[model samples]
Target: MTSLLRISTLITTLSFSGLAVATDVVHFEGKASNTLPEAVANFSEYNDKLEAVMEGELTPEAMSEVHQLSYTLENAIAKMSKELDSLAETLEEVHLASESADTETVSEQGAAYLETSRELVE
Candidate 1:
């Protein structure tokens, strides 16, 4: 009975402490990568670190690390998403032009697409 009481008390204490921690907002002060290339590099680096951290037990410290890393990762993803959206539009234009036998539009848009894509792939 005594052990059960102690366990209940401990659980209650931990629950409150968790709530306190959850209420606090942690901010990432590090500068986010500005360019697409820089954002891509940051995404790769941070994602590797985040994966490594996740492979182990998720203790408080590891969770904190994850929280901090997520900010940079999110920024990278946002930049990539924005750039890729524009690139996809360009590729679509190229495809449409090619279907209509518009050689000039196809050539222009195709080159633009390849140049931007190479930056991501290579």
Candidate 2:
């Protein structure tokens, strides 16, 4: 009887602990930027905000805010990563053309790469 009672108490404790963990899960509904320019803007803004919030000791409230801000940051990074992947391919074309001394291909792909890259820095 004592063993059964002990098992029952353990089960109850486990159930409550699981409930606590479930309640602690936070859901973020932040919107993602649709365009590269929008993503760049969001990435810059949220990155600065996140850095500012991390200056002091992290309280639960600050941690929660950081968690929410991370959603936008993640979205911006995803968009930028996709665009940069394409840009890298273009730059590769320029590199290969330059190596072979193909001035026409080099000029065309190099110009294309620089145009897109300038947008990213500006």
Candidate 3:
């Protein structure tokens, strides 16, 4: 009986703690969506430029610029991907928090997500 009581107490503590960490999910609120599309468009344009460079002469300056553009595009894609992942994870967390009625967690996560997304856009 004592062991069962201890287990019940532990479970209750854990449940409350989990609720304390979860925030509410907001819909269509972050700049992550807008940034991703812009990033994709930039990638397409960069790829087209890269193709043109490849087809043209292989001068030292041209090669250098190509290298720089490729690096920039790769970094941009990676940053955008990270932003997307952050937004998705935040959304999932918010959903779970909402299911458990953890409003504080939801609000915190939503605000953080929005801020991060805005930074990504800038």
Quantify all predictions' global Cα lDDT against the true fold.
0.91, 0.89, 0.72
Among all candidates shown, the one with the greatest TM-score: 1
Could you give candidate 3's per-residue lDDT for residues 2-29 as a string of tens digits?
A: 9999999999999998887564322231
RMSD of 2: 3.0
Model 1: colliding residue pairs: none
**For model 2, what is the C-alpha lDDT against the true structure?**
0.89
Assess candidate 1 and give its TM-score to the true structure.
Answer: 0.80
For model 3, which pairs clash?
22-105, 22-106, 23-105, 23-106, 24-106, 24-107
Question: Each model's TM-score?
Answer: 0.80, 0.77, 0.45
Model 2 clash count equals: 0
Weakest 10 consecutive residues, lDDT, candidate 3? 24-33
Candidate 2 per-residue lDDT, tens place, 64-88, comes to 8999999999899899899899999
The model with the greater TM-score, 1 or 3, is 1
Candidate 1 residue 31 Cα shift, in angstroms, is: 4.2
Error of 1 at 27 (Å): 1.8
Can you tell me which runs of candidate 1 are displaced by over 4 Å?
Answer: 1-18, 29-31
Which is the winner by TM-score between candidate 2 and candidate 3? 2
- Kindly provide the TM-score of model 2 when superposed on the true structure, using C-alpha atoms: 0.77
